[model samples]
Target: MTDKVTINIPVQYEAIAFKTKALGFDMPSDLQTGSLLKTLVASKPGGRILELGTGTGLATSWILSGMDNHASLVSVDNNELLINVAKEQLKDNRIEFICGDGYEWIAAYKGASFDLIFADAMPGKYDLFEETFALLKTGGIYFIDDMLPQPNWPEGHAQRVEAFITMLEKRTDLVLTPLNWSTGIIIVTKTSNKI
Candidate 1:
């Protein structure tokens, strides 16, 4: 067996997970990914952060706890029910939980560049990679996880991931690396603002 140390789920996260299970939502970010988010947010301090999918607020809790007061997070979800549950569980002034279509929301959003973005929603599927990349500040990091080979993945899902990776590889403005970690995270950093 591998000697991977088990990280304790914080009580807040446990509550969120409990709620998620009660709602039959089993797709929240795993502990490894959550921990990585915490670490990433912690390093950014007062930077602006965005999460595309606010599933049960489990990952939002992790990000909020790691961020300072000066930082702000905008997390969006299309499901009103899920967004409400997450808002209730994660009562934080710094986080703006939105319920709407992720694609349309990003399409209309003219907000400042984000220092870090967790594209964890349907948009995270890389359909809007170029638009999302443009939202990132130069030197900003974009995280897309749940990429590890999943037995439950629908047929042809792997092909989409492969095509996305290939597209990223050809980009000259950003540096992309696929980390073979928990869910095969593709970490992208915008090296320049040019398209």
Candidate 2:
């Protein structure tokens, strides 16, 4: 059995504190929120995965741990310092770490597709929703991790994010399920036949 996982506030916070102390890369998600990175990986075995953020490689480790040995992951982040840390922490051959702006990477990967896309980059920085949509294979999973909820959610902020969710829902090609977990997760599975 996979060893049980424990959540320690002190260690988790300390990890962020240590990384921030050594490298200035900002981290958007805390250890408490989001589906267990490990859980997602196990559920989507043998799936090609893409993660937009690799902060301190914490979640990176979780994803790698649960993924099938043959499945590959392309994890991206603009922070060289954080990426470097990830390199050492995540040494598995199945994972590729890239350092660059998420926008640039997403643009380049527009036509390419994957079985799963995990976005923990930032809260409202989800401006690339359309571009992201273009990169998912049919029956693929597009998961958005609410790194943080916009303060103006009530004042139309939620509307903007919700708009993206609404747009995806309108597409008969995809089955959408808004997962009501920590923070929030919008899980979209492509059901459309169109490429």
Candidate 3:
């Protein structure tokens, strides 16, 4: 008899997994979540990607594996300890690891819109949905993860997902699909700039 489970992970991502575990940072994206990010990134060749709350860069590695050579990624995290681990692990020219308040950085950014944005931080912490939406090019994908109830989540955390859903539903500029996979993900695409 054999008990087996198989999943293919890129070498960079594998390294991030080990490093994150060694650092006791359990917030790294699971394999399924990472794979999903890779798939999405692959869809947009030369995409400009933004990742908030870069926890150990497991997902960043996956995204880089799929992104085109011309694509660029900016991953931000407030924790110096965690971001430094990611920066050292992923020493690629295509990626810029920013150690600072993600919200503040995004708020001050006055550059071209992104092709993809992955919001890995807790959903409710982001109060700049309009700004984020504006920063995403029309038809660009915005991913928000960890929306489902988790074993470690405090009581009432699920309500945050609900409120987020409600907010998305009210917005006419974006289309939303709430998927019940890998901690639940809300996939939002900017369909228009209009309110």
Q: Rate the local accuracy (lDDT) of all candidates.
A: 0.84, 0.67, 0.82
Summarize candidate 2's per-residue lDDT along 60-118 as a digit string, tens digits: 76677668877889999887877777786557899889888888888777345778888
Arrange candidates by TM-score, descending. 1, 3, 2
lDDT tens digits, residues 1-195, model 1? Answer: 742525645558888888889999867888778877888888887999999999888888888877899999999899887888789888888989889999998888998989999988668557677788788899888988878777667899898878888888888899988889877888888899775
Most accurate candidate by TM-score: 1
Model 2 spans > 4 angstroms off: 1-28, 31-35, 110-112, 122-125, 147-159, 193-195
Clash pairs, model 3 backbone:
none
TM-score per candidate, chains pooled = 0.92, 0.74, 0.91
Lowest summed lDDT across 10 adjacent residues in model 3 is found at 1-10
Which number leads on lDDT? 1
Q: After superposition, how far is residue 179 of candidate 3 from its true place, in Å?
A: 1.1
Which scores better on lDDT, 2 or 3?
3
Rank order (by lDDT, best first):
1, 3, 2
lDDT of 3 by residue, 1-195 (tens): 421214556777767788888899867787777888888999999889998888888888888888999999988889998888788888899998888887788789998889999988752135677777788899999988888777777787678668878878898888889888777888888898898
Shift of residue 34 alpha carbon in model 2, Å: 5.9
